[model samples]
Structure formats: structure tokens, C-alpha cells
Target: NPRDYKSYKLLFGNEKFYDRSSNITLNYEYFYSCIDNMNISIDQLMSSIQKLQFMVVNLNSPDDDPQLIFESLNSTGVALTDADKIRNFLLMNENLPEQNKYFQNYWQPLEENTHFEVSKFFRYFLTIKNAQFPKISNVYDEFKTTYNNLDFDKQNLFEDINDFSNTYKMILECNTGTKKIDVILNRFLELNVTVIRPFIMAIINDFVSNKIVEEEAIKIVELVEKYIARRIITKTPSNALNKVIATLYRDFRQFQDKHNNQYKDSEVIIFLLLKKQGSGRVPTDEELIRNFKHNDWYNINSSYRSYIFERLENHNHIESLSIYEGLKNKDYSIEHIMPQKLSSDWKNELGNNYQRIHENYVNSLGNLTITGYNSKYSNRSFQDKQNMEKGFKESHFVNLNKLPARSDKWGEAEIIERTNQLITSALEIWDFPESTIHEMIEEKEMYIYDGNETFSNYKIHGFTFINDEYIPVKTWKGLFVELFKLLAKIDLNPLIECTKIDTKIGFESAIFSEKTDDTE
Candidate 1:
């Protein structure tokens, strides 16, 4: 039980009570039993056991790579693991005094904080900073090499590692102050994604450095939660998520042109996310609504679907249900409105379209909800469930679910309508705020045309800005046509399409590069 005094329990059988008296009593009984069974003297048995000596192998080589030597020695037979190797490698190069200092300061604190999960934490840290997952055994080698390439010297390196470990622990524990972010992180944790950690770590740095306000930080983290959740719901290629989030710090840097820093981090993150058009696209409300209608609620990971249920059930309700609370207590379970095992009454309620309704709506969002009576009322007809103990009407989700708003019969039409309603609510819950839209500037397409001027005195005059810089069109008509042909592909947007301007020829440096060709 998580709420137990230990938050965990260890049971003892009293058989291994290792007191001196018990030890002697057990040994004497063993010796007496041996003597009775085999006619062996107690003294001889004791002497034989005492004569056995244990051999210890200590491997040391200043010339060899300690890691290689460790791997060579530690096989299936030994207790040495990747974590042990990492600890040894990190400490091996330090002087005696330095080694003890580092161990007492950086290493011990992390070990205590992570509950001796130091190796796993180190791998997570490496993955976050490097954007690539490391093999467990190679983590120390990767860390050693990668740390050398970084800007920090040895002293700063340890300090940076310690600082990052603290952030990792905060995120891993979901101890981030705000309730909303903490809840969202709990959902993320349940989704079994540690890939988002690198991105979160970067954001936490931004928070610590005052690059973004706390509210904006929350918005960014929440958007990522929705981004991953929607991808899971739509069954998109999740391998793309790691790549997207891994390079998030790089993605954030792309916005560092002059006015970029003036924008709120929420705006920057949301715009960058919206601009992702391929597999990385944060799905639009239309896409979400469409997918939610058809998504198989049962086939989805229970944790993910449970998160969706919690969001649905808690919307507009003051007393929120914690997913953690549910885990620690018998609180809620996902209940299918249209039972998985259909009764005669359910078939009749769905009418002659029973198979169609069953196939489409059985595991769908419209027909599923959070319920306290899942085990008790499961598989009953909707009407029977409505009448059962702690039934649908009493469920906390009833207000949000609005079950009876449609039809008492709960058929295909009602299911479709409810699917639409729930999806709209989902959009409201997970949607990125619309106020951030103004932060993005859409690149408008531009077109260039030869101005109507006499054959001799012709000039490129599309706007006053361009016409104003009247470099007379003469032999350069060939130049402009060549330039226009080089630049134009039907319509060209200066921001989006101008690949490069050949600046060696002075005409290529013409003001037209910055000007919009306003004329048709």
C-alpha cells in the first residue's frame, strides 16, 4: 500500500532472525542433525567448514582502459553492473582527496535523492543533453567523451552535473509547484515517456535563468503534454516524438533573430509547434475531433486513456480527482456505456444496426466514461446500469458526460452526437491558446513582373519602394529577365522562396530583393 507507514512493506519470516543465540542454536542443531544422519563428529564438521577459504580478485591496471578491464572481468558471474562501472570510471582519475570530496558532495547526494537509482539517472541525463539514447553499458564512456567536448573544465563539469541532477529529480518526482503542471506531468509519467525529459530540462533551465516566466513555462509543458497525447491518440509514428523533443533546444534557438526574444515563450513554443507540418504536427482541433470519434479507447494504453478520462470528468468541476489519488485509492475505472458483452436489451436498444453500433461505438470516446460502478454495473443494459447502485446518474462525470441529453436508448445516432460533443470538449481542454497566434508572421508569397516602360527607358517599378530606386533598364533588360527568371517560379515569396541573390553582379544586390512586386 502506497499510504502504508513505509509507503512499502517488507515481510520477514522470523526464520532468519540472525541473533547470536539463534545463530548458535541453529548451528548446533545442524551439527547434531549431521552427526545423527552421517555419524560425523561435531568438531570434524566444524573444522571442515572453517578450513574453506574465499579468494578475492582485485583488478588494477594504470595502462588499460578501466572500463574495458571492468567489462572483461564482470560477466554474468559477477555483481558488477553498468552503474558500478560508471561510478568507478568517474572516480578513478581523481586524486585520493578529490575522489573522497567528489563522492561525499556530488555523488552521494544524487545517490540519496534518487534512492540509489544513480546509474539510471545518469543515463537519462546523458540522453537529455545529447538527444540520443545511450546503451546502458556505454553510458560512462559516452559521458566521459561527451563531457570532454563541452565548454566546462573538470570542476565545472561536476557542478553542472549536480545542478542538472537536481532538476531531473524535481521533474521525475513531479514536484513542480503548480498543480496543473504537476498533474500534466503525472499524465506524462504514466504515458511512460522519459524522452520529454530533455525538453523539460531545457525549459527548466530557461525558468531558472529567467528566460521565461513561470506561467509561460507551464504553458510550454502543457502544450507538450497535449502534443504527445494527441499523437498517441491518433497513432502517429512515435519515433518522431523523440527526434522532435530531443532537438527542442535547437528548435528554440531558431527563434533567436532580433524580435524573437521579445515574444513570450508560450507564443514561441506554440508557434514552433503549430509550424510542424509533417509527423511532428501538433494535431489541429479538426484532426483531434475526427480522430477522437473513431479512436479505439480499449486498445489505447490504459494510462493514456485514463488521463483523457480524468480531463473529461474533471472539467468545470471544483473538486478535482487526482490520477495519483485514484492509483492509491479505489476511485475510478473506465466504464463503457455500450457494454462490450451485449445483452438482448442492448441489441434491441441499438436496434437492427446492433453490429454496426457495436463495432463502431463499443470502445469509442462517445460511449466510454469514468465510473465508480464499473465492476458492479459492467455489461448491463444502459437502462439497467442507470438503475444500479452508485449508478450513471451518481457518477461524477455525469454532468460533463451529459448522458441523458441525447436519447434514453443510447443508439448509433446518440453515440455519434456524444462523440462530437466529447471531442469538442477535448479540444477546449488540450487546445493551445489562441492568443499566441499574433506572435507568428506568415510568409506571404510575392511575384515579379517587368514594368511597362518604353523599350529604351524601361525600369522595374512594382512598388514606390522599387520604382523609387529607378536604375534605368537598358542592356540590363537581359540582366533583369535573367534575374527574374532565376528568381521567379510563377509567384515567389521574398521571405519563403528567395534562396540566394547573386551579389557579385551589382544588379543582384538590387533593392528588389527586399521589395514586394506589387503589380499584377
Candidate 2:
């Protein structure tokens, strides 16, 4: 029996019996014979013994032996096929009555302790192993339960599980034959379902970062859809998930540079719409359809269009204006002031490149405004539209001009100038004083001197100045107070120089008492 043990140990490269092998030929023959006689396959037996040895080493002294075992297993050039069999065998053995007490005394406490870095992975592996191979449904249930029990505000429950699951999947796929069992187990313990979105994001980010699977971005979109659906139904939607999806879609569109493509534009538009709307409720199908039709959102990707409308509806941003009397009424549309097919005369006057300029500026609602009389001036030019409504009676629902006209031919420079003008107009409309307005065209020159002698002179161009000054005077405190009150209205500082002056007055008085005494 000892000789048989020696032969077996030699074949398996058992460290304890290294000296037992003197002849390579004899060792090899003995190893093959043992494999044939035991009616066990060489691969199977080696795997079994390896796993047993690994478990024994770690169980004997986990603090030290686990690391050593990991190194040995990793260095042995063991086949993943064999490693997997050994792992399965050990996992099965964990449930044995004899091993239960050992696990409770050693592994259980380690798994439960949060301070240990490996505890999470260790516990997860044990749980999964004990449960056997779980179906997706079972996994989902486990995730839901785990999520329900967590305190989200205190712990970032989503990020942790997402990382673990991704790592776990990678390990399962790679099968590198390294027995980092403790690491694997720790990951399993830390995992929960809340991490699904983050895991998807990580995968998408990795793909994008590596540029390995550019086409796989579609898969990310599908995953996002699933995540959104699940969260909406479960009422546990993550704001982080929403923001990530929005940002990812935006980046993807930018990478594609599909500016003219309706699909790309729709995706960006939808993302913006959803972001504008706050979270919680999901939009109804009818509401989505209505908004899309009313806004002329056709020729765009249907799914993306619906998503934006839905998000807006969810936040109550798309509700009827009549519902809230006090709130200002707002309606959304895509207004084209210069109709797409312009007349030859207008185009010639505007410039031969008018189509491009018009598309750049006149197509969007930002360049348009809400007016009650949509039918009367749907596609009129600025001048014509103004003339048509000049004598129109004022009513509560009267059509007001939406956007100021482009004074010159529509071009890049003209568009930029008009945009700036509109912004300034908006500021003024909001009660900004003319003096306080920042003038981009003007330059201010300042002269500074030391002891009234000029020392430095410079001009600060394209910057606005704010004047803050007070008067200093003696015996004119009342005047200073009045000056300040007046200065508040005028935004310029008052320049004052102090000077002293004296005045004399002549008067006559009678003094006869002293003179009369001298005479007496």
C-alpha cells in the first residue's frame, strides 16, 4: 500500500513524496499501471487528487496555505478541464455532514466577516455551489430578494454586484486553470441584481474604449431597453442608469457623426426630452403617439421618438395647458419659417447657399415661438407675417411673433448674430437694465497715475465694467446721502474733488456803556 501510494504520488507530482521517484521509466510505467488498475481515467484521477490536495492545504491553514495552493495550481500547467472537475467535486463535498462542522467553524465565519476583502467572493461561491446551477429565473429571484433587503442610500448596492457578475462571467469564459477559489467566492458574495445597469455600462464602455466591437453598441442599446423595461415595471428605476444611457447614446451618435440621418437626430432629441422630464412614472402609449403627431416628429426612428414623448409625459411636462390656469402655457413644435422649397427669387436674394443656411437656422422651434394663430402664419416670412397680423385684434389667444427675423441673408455669421441678439433680447425681457448689459463691441480705456502723475494707460476691450463708488466730503453728509440715492439710478461713478473756501460779512452795533463811564 505504501509503495502504491508512493507510485501514485510520483505520477501526480505530490510535493511530499518528491524523493520517492528515482527512475523516470519506472515512475511513468507505475503511474500508467495505477491508472489502468483503478479503472479510473488518468485525467479524472489527477483532477480529483489535485482538488483534494488543494482543499486539504487550504482547510489545514487557510491564512497561509490558500495563497500557496493558488500559486501551485496556477504554476502546474493544469488543464482547465481537470480543474473544473476538481472544483465540482469539492463543491459537492462541501454539503457532506462530516464537512459541515469544519465549514461552520472555519469558512462560515470568514465568509460572514465584512472586514475581510475575500469574504464576499468566498460566500458567493459557496452559496452558488450549494444551490447548484441556478437558472436565469432563479438568479433573477435571488437578485430581487437581495435588492429589496439592501439600504440603497447607505450602500452602493448596484455597482458592487455589477462588477462581481462581470468578473464572474469573464472567469467562467476564460477558464485559465488558476484556482483563485477564494477570489471567485468573494465576488459571488458581493454580487446582487442592483448592479445590472452598471455591468451593462461597463461592458459598453469597455467595447467603446477598446474599439474592439464597434457594432456591438447595438447590443448595449438592447440591454438598456431591457433594463429600462424591468426598472419601470419593478418601480426601482435608477437615475444613474438613465443618465448613463443618455450619455452613451449621445456619444455613440457623435462617433457615428450621422448628423443628417433622422435616426441619429431622433435618438439625441429623445434623450434630451427624457432628461428634461424628471423620473418615476412611465408615459402612456396614447400620450406618446399624440405628442409625436402634434410635433411633426415623423421620419424619425419611432422607438426613440416614443421614448422622448413618454418621458415628457411621465414628468407631467406634456399635460394640457387648461389643467393649470396659473402656470404659463407652453407648446412644442418644429417650425420652419423658410419653407424647405424656397422660391427662386427669395433664394437668389438670400444667396445661392440659402438652402443650407435656412436648414441650419429656420428649421428648429428654438428659432420659432408659440402663437395662438398657427394657421394664419404657419410659413410666412418675417416681414410678410408682421404685415398680415398688423391690424389683427388683440385677444387672449392672439398669435405673437415667436422669433426675431434674421435681418440679413441667412448664413452662419447671420445665424450667430441673430442668436446673440435673441439672447440679449431675452435678458432684456427679463428686466435686465440697459446700462448693466455687457457690450461685446465696445472697449474701455483706463488711465492710472501715482500721486496724480500718469503711470499706466491701457484699454480693456470686450469686457463689461461694474461701477461701485461713494462720495467723501466733510460738512456735506446730507449731500453725500442724496448723491448715493441718485447714483443708484445712474450706473456711472461720480467724480468729485474737495476744496475749502471762507466768506466774511459786515454789520453795525451800538456800544455807549463803556464810553459814558470814562467821561464821568
Candidate 3:
């Protein structure tokens, strides 16, 4: 009893009082005081703990069903986890010897290797088979229904689960024992893109089963990365991605079957993703490029911003630095070249329309760069930032800092130039997948944008925004109205702000107003 007290004291020591990860605090002093009164206090505590009553049900008859009883009894309590029910149902009917064999061969290894994430494993595994994610609360019932529907023995089901669990483990660990695959896996993990895992696991399963080579599998993962990265940049809603990624592999397989498996897996994936329409369509190169300049990327997910900068700096380089490590170590940060808070010097350098310039490009990619001198560079003028030690001129990120270091002025024109440069590099990093199969898609009559084109010379059929579905335009006024409607749907605050600024819309009267008579 004294030895047990000492062991537990070591576990709940003063140094172990608080856990940051779980946000739990232990009252180690009280615990130690109770244990210090060992003989009297612990004896009373142990007696009370031992005397606590628990109802035990005994199933003595041949017709007794332990699984049903277990489910019924646990219906109102702390609630058994899906994993608990699944594990019990798996071994509940077997004799002790058979249970031990199955536990040792399949279930135990799966539990341990997945780091006890069997519930999540079951959900992803079921998603692969069903092409839809099971509700978190319904995982047990969903898996039970799946088990009953299929003609499967315990060994066959166990084998399938055990095999898939190994792949799932690699994904969770982000270490697939192959450096190339692991790198992409790390990106997916960093972005917290959990919805893509079922499809990723399916591809990895193919690679393991010898259905596809390692190279092709790597290509497919990279393709998926491009898909995800583009969608994020184009500001696509994440809720739509789950359905797209869940059904992608099934659709690919069906497409392959139809073509008699003539196409490579990567080619099939490209065609399948390209064929997607509406909210599910893959963002094209043009859309990605446009978003790079237009979107306030600095305010998006920090992990996504890190991924973009890292790829831009390191892609095709002879030497690479880990931007993630630099950022985490506090030795680097995102620097706004055009400082967020402008001083008189910055205002003068930016010219008379400084407020407009700052509002437009302050958080855009061109005005941002990673720097080790974040504190020193704070609110400094552009020339000072360039000339300061360990500033843009001295930064090791040659791809990012080089062009800006050479620039003499920082203003709207400079931001636009730098943005165009960054956009070019971004295109190279997250380039669209190309295939002759793309030519197979029927083209809509999209008129090219030329400054000299007149509405009177040609009939405008429709227009599209960011590669979305075409919206028909019957008149120039109709086109103007529809464009504003789409923009208002996205965000009306910018439109409302436009009415307050005289220079914004170049109109004699307010274009948007609360009163209908306020505008001509």
C-alpha cells in the first residue's frame, strides 16, 4: 500500500499539476495529503470503494444474448463508445479460445496500431464502402447493418478491417515509410483536411494491393492536393467537399470499369474531377490566379498560408528550408511589406490615394512576405524594411524577397506588379492537371474579354464567375444586375460600403441607396 502511494505520487506530482493539451489540472497536494495519512485514511477509502454496489447480470440460459443485453443495459448510462460496442459484438458470440485467437490476430493489433482510434477508423472504413460518411453517433448501428448485409465470416471481416486499419494508421501518423508519400500526407494533416482521408485511404489501399504502382499513387495524392489547394484558394465552402471526396473513388472505379481499365488511375482521377460541375467543379488555373490577387489570403487559415509560401519558395529549388519550422520557432513570420498601420512616411510614399491603396492590397499576397525581423520591421516604411538587416534584401527566401528588394517604391502600382509576379509563381506551384481528355468536355460559348469588343457587335449569351456555372444574360442591364446580385450574395458589406465612397462607382448619384428615389 505504501509503494502504491509512492508510485501514484510520482504520477500526480507537483510538476504534473496541469496538462496543457487536455486543459486538466490535478490537485496533487490534496492527493498527497490523503495518501500521507496512509493507514487510517487509505484504509477507509479503499473499504468505501470496495463496498460500492454494481448490478451484474448473469446469462445462464442457452438463448441468452449478451450483445442485446449489453446494448439495452448501456442505453442510459455513460454510453458505450462505438468502438466498445463493435469490439464486444465481434467477440461476444465466440467461445473463449476463438475470442482469444481473433483478439490476438486482428482486433488487438488494430486497436493498438491505430492508437486506440478505432471509432474514427470504423467511420472512415465504412465511408469507403458506402460512399457516405456514417453519422458519428450512428457508427455502431451503421457498421452493424453493414456486417449483417454482407455474407462475411469473422475472419473475412476482420481481415478487411485489419488491413484498412494499417493504412489508416499510416495516414494518422503521417509517416507512410516513403518520404514522397509522407510529404503529401503531412500537407493533408497540416491543413486538417480530414474529409479527404477516405479517398486517400482507398488510393493507398490500391497501392498496397498491387492494383496501382507506387508512382501512380503518389501522382494521385498530389492531384488530390492540387484539387484541395485550388478549392481553398477559390474560397469554396468546405461543407461541399465531404460529399465530393467521399464519392470520388467510387466514381473513378465505375469510370474505369466502363473504359475496360484502359486508362491509368491518375488519368481517370483527372477526368472524373474535371467532369465535376456546379459547386463541385475543380478550380481552373484562371480562377486560382484571380483569387491569388483578389482574395485576402493573409486572413485565411494560417496553415494554408504557410503551405502556399513554402511551396512557392521551395518548388524546383536546389536547397529548401522548412517554412513551418521557421514559423513555429518564432524565427520567421508573415511580414506586411505595406505595413498594416501606415505612418506619415508610408502615406507620403504611397501617394495621395494611400487609404484606397492600403484598403485594396494591405492583406493581399503581394504586400506579404515571411521575415525573421518581424518585430524590427513593424510599421517601418518600405525603404527601411528593404534596407534593414535581415529584411527583404537579406532574406533567404530568394523567390519571394528578391523582386521586392529591387523595387524602389511601395504603392498601388508596386503591389499590383508584385502580385502579378507572385501569381505566376503560384501557378507553377499548384498547377492544374492537364489531359487531352479535357478536350472531350463540350465547351460553352464563352466570349473572350477584349477592351474593344462592343455589345452591339455581338450577342452576349451568358457570363460566369470564377469558373462557376454560366448565368444567362439577356441584356447589358440584365448582365449588370445579375453580376451585382451574385456579388451581393457572396457579401453585401462591400457593396454597401461602395455607396459611401464617391470614387468607387464613378456615378453622379448613389448607385445603391436605402430610398429608391436617391439614385437616378
Q: State the TM-score for model 1.
A: 0.70
Q: Candidate 1, 413: how far from true, in Å?
A: 2.3
Task: Give the worst 10-residue stretch by lDDT in candidate 3.
Answer: 511-520
Clashing pairs in 2: 120-186, 121-185, 121-186, 121-187, 122-185, 122-186, 124-188, 124-189, 369-402
Question: What C-alpha root-mean-square deviation, in Å, does candidate 1 show against the real structure?
Answer: 14.4
Q: Alpha carbon lDDT of residue 287, candidate 2?
A: 39
* lDDT of candidate 2 over 102-162, digit per residue (tens): 3344333332332222323323432332222223224333433444566663124323433
Q: RMSD for each model, in Å, please?
A: 14.4, 28.6, 10.9
Give residue 515's error in model 1 in angstroms: 42
Model 2, residue 378: displacement in angstroms? 3.3
Give the count of colliding residue pairs in each prediction.
Answer: 1, 9, 0
Residue-wise C-alpha lDDT for candidate 3, range 316-430, written one tens digit per residue = 7877788788888988898888988999999998888989999999999888888878676679888888888887788788988877788888888888888898888888788
User: Which residues of candidate 1, in runs, are more than 4 Å off?
Assistant: 1-71, 75-80, 135-137, 257-260, 327-330, 405-407, 433-520
Displacement of the residue 368 alpha carbon in candidate 2, Å: 4.4
| TM-score, cand. 3 vs. native | 0.77
| Candidate 3 local lDDT, residue 327 | 89
List TM-score per model, in order. Answer: 0.70, 0.22, 0.77
